[model samples]
Target: MNLTRTWIALIALSAGSTALAASGLTGRAFALAVLALAWVKAELILRRYLHLARVPAIARGFSLGLAIFLMLAAGLALIPA
Candidate 1:
């Protein structure tokens, strides 16, 4: 994606996350939804701004690592705290 489009997407995702936070939802589902939005925003920044899309192998590695970390975070978020 182009930088302009990526920027717009990031903005939209931020808006969505903010809306979700203000929607009075709670629990694991809400946490996962916010985290998913965060994942997309991170991916866009990584690919477009960081120019990682040109390197498919490195991009996949970073994306996979991020996915693993987010999954673990999601799991932890599900635990009572």
Candidate 2:
């Protein structure tokens, strides 16, 4: 995607996340939703802004690392404190 489109997408995702946060929701589902948005935003930044998309291998590696970290985070969030 072009930079402009990426920027717009990031803005939209941020707005969505903000709206969700303001909705007074609480739970694993909410956390996962927010984290999912975060993951997409992070991918956009990495691929478009950082130009990681040019290197397929590196991009995949970064994406995999991010997915693993987020999954672990989601799991931890689901656990009772």
Top TM-score hit: 2
Clashing pairs in 2: none
Off by over 4 Å in 2: none
- What are the C-alpha RMSDs, in order, of all predicted structures? 1.0, 0.8
Error of 1 at 68 (Å): 0.7
Candidate 2 to truth, TM: 0.95
Tens-digit per-residue lDDT, 1-81, candidate 2 = 899999999999999999999999889889999999999999999999999999999999999999999999999989996
What TM-score against the true fold does each predicted structure earn?
Answer: 0.94, 0.95
TM-score (C-alpha, index-matched) for candidate 1 = 0.94
Task: At residue 4, give the lDDT of candidate 2.
Answer: 98
